[model samples]
Target: MNLFTDIRALVIDSLTALQSEGALPEGLDFANVTVEPPRDAAHGDMATNAAMVLAKPAKMKPRDIAEALAAKLLQDLRIEVAEVAGPGFLNMRLAPDLWRGVVGAALEKGRDFGRSSMGQGRKVNVEFVSANPTGPLHVGHTRGAVFGDALAALLDFAGHDVTREYYINDGGAQVDVLARSVFERYREACGLTPDIAEGLYPGNYLVPVGQALKDKVGDSLLDKGEQFWLEEVREFATEKMMDMIRADLASLGVEMDVFFSEKSLYGSGRIEAALEELDAKGLIYEGVLPPPKGKPDEDWEPREQTLFKSTDHGDDVDRPVKKSDGGWTYFAPDIAYHYDKVQRGFDELIDVFGADHGGYVKRMKAAVSALSDGKVPLDIKLCQLVRLFRDGQPFKMSKRAGNFVTLREVVDLVGPDVTRFVMLTRKNDAPLDFDFAKVLEQSKDNPVFYVQYASARIHSVLRKARDAGIAVDDATLKAADLSLLAHEAEMAVVKKLAEWPRLVEIAARTNEPHRVAFYLYELAGEFHALWNRGNDLPELRFLQEGDSSATQAKIALIRSVSIVISAGLGILGVTPAEEMR
Candidate 1:
């Protein structure tokens, strides 16, 4: 169903036939041959570099080989015309029947239209939204959550066994901070003026957690010292926060297959086990690290610390696995967690970290590399900041989240569908501007609206055809005489449709779901352009008043486009609009 792959195979078969007929040398490497859409659609449907790539290897002139290859390719029924273009580059124009076949394929596939088997069922772990278990997820976690979830879905659609996971940061001092904050609210619940000190969480969301603590423990923990209550309160408060976090994620349509806790890595021998595996290979050592370059920490000094030889892989220097106080550094638990992932046999790993964690990327990759011993690969994607805008100015800060905006606020304003689509409107590494006014704008400039409008238009045609007593189901539309869809403008829409499977493979291989969003936008643009062209060319219109047969042909073409759009939107966690409101 992939036109480019299909055509490339045809080119390969022809090259082999040329070799068999003694038109070329016995042995020639054809690895470099590729069939792809030409830079400009004006060039042709697809262009191949087979003749050019083999010219030097086969001792033939570029044009001489192209002419022969063109002649051989033209003999095939799929290719209507094969012409040798600049420097032995063979450009091809497949018959309109081939475009018709693409539509038929998409209609048959439905939601699985662009699904690919490129991963070959390899297991991949996509860990994202591992927000510290200190509070409800904010705007930053929302982006990471959506990006990771969409990415995992994209990989699954591309044939990877993807597991969505969240790593909780409960082992760190942050959880202790959460306990103290909740304790203040607990005292307030007990009718005392709680100490609202600096460094304590000021959000009112934890007020319920404090009130719940009094109900559970009664007067047992009342007026107790930090040493007496910190442990029990930390455990109780973390569970409450996690419940709140889960509810927040569920509201946004995110579900994690695994919720790994950082606390579990401590005192579980897992950290020691992971480092032991590395140390067994001579990758761990106790060493006094050199001070960092240029403006080192004012408190920095040389200290012999247990370090991992991260430099052996790709890091700039060896990294500390343990602090000077003999407790493991934050990176130690992280390495252990990933080592556990590798031990569990994930063929590949991807971590979705926020942009501020950009500095940790290299060390993490180095650990996965060392742990897997080059068998498995790791990819870290950093989601940059999303600045919210409304009323032509910066979005106001959330009162609940204090200075930081909560994820719920953005979802409440623009809605989950609009928020998800707008978040994916840019590359993950690039900063995004979420303008409330622009996203809600029902115009072409708004990508979510543009894509949804295309689907809505398709639904409108379906409803009209149904009301007119014409069968418009996929089975019927797929069976239509698609030969009537041979018009160039109509075929152009098919060309974009043909690119879906290829786009899926590319986006999944790159671990980028935004590419799906971008491709859907382009497909919508093509459909819209063809719709506009129908105004001038009556034959190209979906509804031919006099002939139901010809009308079904064009409807079949656009309906297939709608199917692919729905599939792509599904991967992006977006709902296709049946009717624009």
Candidate 2:
């Protein structure tokens, strides 16, 4: 049901005909030919560059090729007008019935209307929001979580077997700090004044982890030294922090298929095994890395260390796997983690990190490339910072998170749907300003609200038609007299609907789910434009008074709009509004 694809196929067939007639060279490459919407609506519904691309290769003038191709395309019933516009661009106007079929196709397919098979069932692993299990997730983690989750959904819709994953940083020093902080709470549970030290976590969220520890083991570990209780409390507190993080994600409708533990990679011989694989490939060596560029490192004396030959795989320089003191560097475990993923047979890997981790991207990619031998591609998306505003003023930090606004704070203020939608309104690498005042406003400036309102308006129209005894169910509307939908405004909406499948594939291929949000906004604008036109042109309304045939045809159009909107919102993990308040 992809009209553009269908039209492009026709163009290819016509070019083959030209080859058969010897009007063009035998076996001319047609891969560069493309059929898409014209830059200006006045040009035509679809434009093709077949003539332009083939002109140089065929040793013919572009206009001659375009005119010949246009004549052949005009023979098809689906194409009404095919004309040469610019030097070689062939713009086409499709038959109204062809555009009308889009509405019927949407009804028949429902939410699966725009789903694509471009991914061809490839397995993709998306890891995001690997926030340290030290406290509740903050605003920065929220953006990553939302972006990652949406990307997974988009890939799923585009026919990829997507595994949503989280890498737990509990194996790091941060967990030790969490244990010390919880130990303070454990002491507080023992009716003593706990010292909230400067280098320790000061958030009250750990008070419950403290209470849980007290409940599980009572005051037994209260007076114990750091060695006696550090391991036991660190394990207990990290589990609590992960539980809190899971709850936070649930509030925003994000669920991970796998929660990989950094600690699990340790003490399991996994790190050594991963490095051994690299060592077998001669990628591991003892060497002294040159001083890093762009900054002075006073302590940057040359020290021989175990390193990964990352430069061979496109890194700026070889990276140290083991520090001079022989402890594993932070990069070692990450290498092992990706190697484990490759061993699991995922065809692709995607990591969502905060923008601050930009410098780590190249080395991580190099490691994955070496491990997978460039068989599996890795994409790291960096989410820039989010600045919160309320009443045109900077939002203050949360008392729970201490120095940052918690994800719960934002979700609590505007609920999950708004939070997810607003977070994705901006590109992942672009700074986003989350203004409570603007996002909550019921206006077109708010993309989430505008898109949701369009869905709500469709539901409202369907309800009215049903109450008036006009059958508006999908089955009925799909089988309705769609030929009666001849209005120019109605055709414009159908054209927009026709672009959904194409848009889905583009967004999925680029690994950008924000494109879905942007497309939904544009589709909503088209729908709203059509709806506003109905006020001035009585015949343009969805429900024509006393004309059941006309009413069904128009209802079919807008109903299709809702179908696509719901699918788009579904990919974004946002609930399509049934009614607006």
Candidate 3:
């Protein structure tokens, strides 16, 4: 029961009635008409731009259209007041019973109160945290993991068949580097003086990988050169690193539906098949790209190579698929991967990347566009860097992760709930400061705490009501005399509850889950405001003394708040606090 959408339909019906009655023109498009909350609460509960948008198309004055529309709307029993504001804007106040119905709907629906069917069951593939399997996931990957997981959850709530995937970057030079680094540790484990090369990984985290390799193959690989052992050790070390990465993600409550390997694309004829599809469309060519803008002549080397005509699909320049050495560039496997996704019949694709990969976005989109032949849409979200601070000072790096803070370190400090909620406190494109001291602080400034506290408070009320021998179960509270909830303070919270379904559609449409976090905070604020108001007025309190009926009515209102909070936190992969310690 989306109140805004329900009311908008009423507005549209009224507009059609106006046209039928000859009070308005015969034909007018209502697509641009919108029903949303007024900028100022003083105006009304909701505002519509129907008259403003249709006036020009219908060849009528703005005020005349608004006045006529307002009269038509006021005839409906759900609309308590319909006032025409300046320039054909119609502001409306819905009947109190309509707001009361939102509370009942929430109790009836429980966590499903705000779920939407906006996506209409479209298949969506969200690929995120595709970090290299060379080490544990760092803080940047943590943000992407949280963002992508939450986005997948949000899309699922919006009725999309979402597949959470991780693309393993094992078929690259980095995995070879990881093997050499582990070989040094293997040498160390074998009681030899190991040469820790400068370019090889220098983290102590590889000590276990080395010890494991020694345990598996023993001294047989001790005296062998790269040619004798690199392949065997590379596959072994890559699996160990992937094991560590999986544990890191599991610590944060992120689970992928698929773990795709880049190595599979290399030997399976998939890359050639993807390129062949593009070649059939005349998108593949042998050409030389111009020198990059900032390159000096001495450093610029132009060579004819196998390239993809990415410019034809929106990229700024054509991209090379194969270098002059006949080796596939990094972009080649990526194209194959997305092409594989398209072949799987997904209707849409979303990739969550780090801020440093901003330059790679256009080329990737172009590749997917060319591969899918403009059928599937790809949305790439870039998560900026996360700067860690402890006690207002820069936090130290994790020795286990070489030089960066591991996602496990942050989760260990504050647990998964706080970690997940705090990561999404900002948008994906904005830089976030994760302050250990501040996020753990039990105050309003902490959004995770604030939202959780609201849930805890609601539970506390239910427990108190239960102990007092009042029935506060969902079925009972839902059947309460909700008409008793006529107080302005109670209505304010209900109005916020009514906005949840609308907010979910907005967030899903923009592919921004941060909006859900923001809406949860605002809903908590409204709930807390009503909770504070009860201090000055006894009638506003949840447990009204000697009146079980009144208490049930008020408890119903707060129970509705808990329902929405749980749903919102679920989308964020956060566990709502039953009671905040």
Better of 1 and 2 by TM-score: 2
Which of candidates 1 and 3 reaches a greater TM-score? 3
RMSD in angstroms, candidate 2? Answer: 1.2
Candidates ranked, most accurate by TM-score first: 3, 2, 1
How much does candidate 3 score in TM-score? 0.99
lDDT of 3 by residue, 10-78 (tens): 999999999999999887899999999999999999999998888888999989999998988889999
* lDDT at 44, model 3: 96
Error of 2 at 326 (Å): 1.0
Cα RMSD (Å) per model? 1.4, 1.2, 1.0
lDDT of 1 by residue, 1-581 (tens): 78888899999999899889888888798889999998888888899988888888888998888888888999999988888887788889998888779999998988888788998999999999999888888989999989999999999999999899999899988899889999999998988888979998888888889999999987678867899999999999999999989998887889999999889888899999999999999999989988888986889888999999999999998999999999889999999999999999999999999999999999999999999998999999999999988867998887786568888888888788888888898999999998889999989999999999999999999899889888889889888998888777888898899999999998998988999999999999999999999889887788899799898988988899889998999999998999988
Count clashing residue pairs per candidate: 0, 0, 0
Lowest summed lDDT over 10 consecutive residues: which window, candidate 2? 396-405
> TM-score per candidate, in order?
0.97, 0.98, 0.99
- Deviation from native of the Cα of residue 291 in model 1, angstroms: 1.0
lDDT against the true structure, per candidate, is 0.90, 0.93, 0.94
Model 1 misplaced stretches (Cα beyond 4 Å):
none
